[model samples]
Target: MRGWWQDLTDLVLPAECAGCGTPRTVLCPRCRAALAGGVPRRVRPVPEPPGLPAVYAAAAYADEVRAAVLAHKERGLISLAAPLGAALAGAVRAGLRGTAAGPPGTAGAPGGHGGGPAGGGRAPVLLVPVPSARQAVRARGHDPTRRIALAAAAGLRRGGVAARVLAVLRQRRGVSDQSGLGSRQRRENLTGALTTAPHGAALLRAGPVVLVDDLMTTGTSLAEAARAVTSAVYAARVREEMEAYRTGRSRKEGNPVYRASEMRRAYGAGHVICAAVVAASPDSVVENQELTKNVHRCR
Candidate 1:
């Protein structure tokens, strides 16, 4: 398999830190810390966007984290998933650590932030990925956001967090490529354009959900995902409450997405937000003028 080849090559390859490229190691110790560094802070994508659940970022959109994410996303270094997931897991734990700064109510919403019981033992956390357009996936040859979410879930599971990825989220309608758009245009492009797939919304009622995205810039993308997620959460809550009353059963075993204890109780954020952007375009990387000092010796 390709993954096996990559693993083998990793051993023989003269490597650089995926984060900072210190050389010789797939990842360096210091950069590893940087990737997982920082408390998960609540990031607001826009001023007028609806109330979004708390989001935890492992590292600021700077330095090493940016490089690692770019390597994984653009270059397709599939092997980097492990380290990225590990970093994401750490961020999630930090966000769960009391008082990270989010909307004031959610810490008070159904589950409260204090590691307390929602109603049953503890509310489960579901990691959801913001869907990418089919065309982009086709062009890139892989679903970047979905892939990262899977990696994060695996990391969380290994940590005994019992996390899972529910890929039921999808786009409601199509929008133009955001590449040429400014912040305002990007906002317009994504506005009201996302909707949950058939059972996606219903599943969230049972536990907490944290929507995951690879990167967050002006927050337009995240805001859209959050809106779609919230719609689903409320719908699921209403349906589950009604179903419980009608069926007189604790949970609908038929619907794994919405088992009583597993309904989405929290929504958070995770992104590989980066530094050193290009082209100054929507999501391009900029070249380092100073780094050229060593390379071409441009004066």
Candidate 2:
């Protein structure tokens, strides 16, 4: 029934592959394989931005993968979201597996905040999509990253890993276009531009977050997004500590929690298990370390 419907739909619509223009298919198998030919691996931008979470990418942004991304993002080929999302799901799984050896507070580790014991008490992985500018979304007529994140989350759930998309990040202000900006200029443009949505703190504390984006160039956006999330978590922890102190319910043994810096240090800002993007530039992968080692060491 499903195949017949697809055949009928293709016949009427005259569909073609988004990547290679193959007849009668939304995406051909060859292009789909190109999107994730190798296992996802850690990728880092040169002159890595401070506070940037470790990122995993399924494929380098080149050839067919690059064509597919551009088609979906710029050409309004919305049907490409599914295949792109499946590629993202592969990257997400790679991020999860990479963190399996991470300490507590990280996702996918035994007894970790996101991956708890085997008895169904695990915290669901939260997929936090980086926000695009309001103007950009309006111009494109869709939120591409958020849509892909949602599809990736659905794929993760189907694969037996609890996951959900959390659209909590928002732009606090506008900035100029990033098309012509260099790395440092891009960082300057995005600094302090993002913030969490109202009630984001409570939601953040419920599980470990993995930043999601469709692409990564200079890594400026991801770094800024991480800073915003960390700032929110820091503020929330401070508020909780202050309330506990005032109510005589403080958990400290002797020294009172008076110093803001101390509290910040104790809670350690925010924790992003890692990041995942559908594709990234080949030059962005760090050159100084082995591939597997880099994947494990980035926390």
lDDT of 2 by residue, 97-190 (tens): 7765433443466555433322355567788999989887887767889989998988887777677888999999989899999999999999
Among these predicted structures, which one has the highest lDDT?
A: 2
Regions of candidate 2 where Cα sits further than 4 Å from its true position: 1-14, 100-107, 111-119, 254-270, 286-299
Error of 1 at 68 (Å): 0.8
In model 1, the number of clashes is 21
Q: TM-score for candidate 1, please give it.
A: 0.67
RMSD of each: 9.1, 5.7
What overall lDDT goes with each candidate model? Answer: 0.57, 0.76
Model 1: which ten-residue window has the lowest total lDDT? 272-281
Model 2: worst 10 consecutive residues (lDDT sum): 290-299
lDDT of 2 at 38: 62
